[model samples]
Target: MSRDIHKKPFDEGTKAKLAIFRDYLREWLPVFIAKREIYWNTINIYDFFSGPGSDGFGNKGTPLIILEELNPHFDNIISKKLNVNLYLNEYDQSKYEALKKNVSPEKGDVRPYSIQIENLDFKISFKSKFPEMGNKGNANLLFLDQTGVKHINEEIFSKIINLKQTDFLFFISSSTIKRFAEHPSISRYIKLNSEDIEKTPYHKIHRLVLEYYKSLIPQNKEYYLASFSLKKNAGLYGLIFGSGHVLGIEKFLTTCWGIDKERGEANFDIDEDKIQKGQFDLFTNEVPKPKKVDLFEKELKEGILNKSLPSDKAIYLFTITNGFLPSHARKIIAQLIKENKIQKSSFNLSTKVCKSGALVTQVKPL
Candidate 1:
């Protein structure tokens, strides 16, 4: 976890991505800070694995970005009997000290700051900070940005989901995982931890990682909870944003995705208004009805071995879901067919939340 040779100047790709993340946060925090009738006074942001702020080439970290935008809102914050708590955690003392100095005591009418620097691993630090969180009912939104998923697994994720009123936006940095996903040792780690998941196929592993967390949500009778996830890109990098509130999930996606350019690598098509307004809407669910899953099931049923030639229907659905979409019911059916592990007649819905986020309804096979 120490510094390495690759730590030269900040990676341009990562820096640009962070800029987009910060911009979205500024516009959206104001809305959340004052949106509800509920007296929203204290704002708590925990940045675990917080690296040295203002890294090489002056790439402002998330902590600084949050403070710059939020400090001004404190005018409205304390006026309404509110406080802002920024819990910045970095095991590296040098970096932590730098951050502490960066956002020190404020001037008159300035937002008051209470900062706690924990020189410990993320799990220990978070557990100490929010002991009640691992149980349930303590409202917290965690930002888990790690260099790798080596230490992050389902068990840790399970403990996090147990917290009531908690939402998580985790950066499952893929470059690290992709390197080890196919390794036998890594596969052993996953299989030993997740007994039901037999395949380590990238997307399936992605699904397993998310579903494992979802399973941790206490099956409470009074609360209607549907925990969900978001994967940024296959394994190179993905964010698993979990929320009990559906709207919060929607808002999270609306804010973060707005900043994403629809195209990749050599191509880019960022909506000017979205960019100017500092919003990320790349994955907004504008379509009224979730696209049908029949197409996905059939395509895979026929054959989806070739990645380059996605079936026409698959292409259309990909366009509909903005590349991240997948019809679980359809995929399950097709996968079962391909492997002879499941039957088509069993496709009749027995009450399951559909991927398009539609209500649990009886669905006949496509």
Candidate 2:
């Protein structure tokens, strides 16, 4: 039930990740909250691994970060008289108390948020209460920012993924999984039999685990996955985002590329193009070089050759297949039209244009 019992300072990589997650929520919350106008009446945000409000070294954990990000949105929602719910769950006693204290409004502080702070185990809390949350017609964003993968087993993930319009940001230490890929306690969750674990290359274990878990998700659901890795020396841990909607995936990748300047896309494998020895660039955003741009353009052309894909579906296929952002795909699709390699049957070639039911066809060679 407990993670590494000893406490340590929150590393810089973790802090950068927290900032990226916060920025993503800052952009996504308004759009998500406005869903009340079209689809849902309420938005529920669940921070399942609500850590001790801070690392005790001045660095705030996910719970405090999420609360701060949501405060302004909460006020806006209240002004509009719409409902938004915050569910914060922490199992550890001291951390739970800290989470509750941190989220509680001080004297005369009127923050219009319906906050439910809990001290129960996340699995039990999620399983018992998720039915109500799922049935409420709320767009739920569950943050499973755990210390490890213990609480995010197959059963829990399946339950959450089955809920309607729900998205999750799950944190895991790939180093831990690589070390324990053959361990009986964890092997079953990743669907790795003892034999497969023994035979699989260590470098490939993370992909195997990710793909296995992804396969468990419902096939009929249009799910998109993107992972952002936080590197500490040779070790890497990161957040895996699962969303049933394309917009969710878009925002997640946008955050990933924004935070990690050394890497353009969300690739799980460590890249040879390492960042400066001791530097982390949280501010600089280097545009993809011409080489990478051409690679993506080539993939986009291959995506629709001889196939008449709806503009929206083509973007989805191109993005998923190439690991480029949706915007990247749109840019390449536009370039293709200009070069006479692709034709758009309807609207002008643009990011939002694709989703307008326009038909896109690859201009086959004569």
Query: What would the per-residue lDDT of candidate 2 be over residues 228-258, giving only the tens digit for each residue?
Result: 6666445556677887776777777777777
State every prediction's TM-score relative to the real structure.
0.60, 0.82
Q: Number of clashing residue pairs in every model?
A: 10, 0
The TM-score of candidate 1 is 0.60
lDDT of 1 at 76: 63
Instruction: Give the root-mean-square deviation of each candidate in angstroms.
Output: 11.6, 5.0
User: For model 1, how does the per-residue alpha-carbon lDDT over 47-154 read when each residue is reduced to its tens digit?
Assistant: 787776667455677777767767667656655555556677887777777767766665663455466666688768877877634433223556776765654565
Candidate 2, TM-score vs. the true structure? 0.82
- What candidate 1 gets wrong by more than 4 Å, as runs, is 1-6, 39-41, 105-109, 132-139, 182-235, 261-366
Residue 214 of model 2, lDDT score: 75
Supply candidate 2's per-residue lDDT for 253. Answer: 71
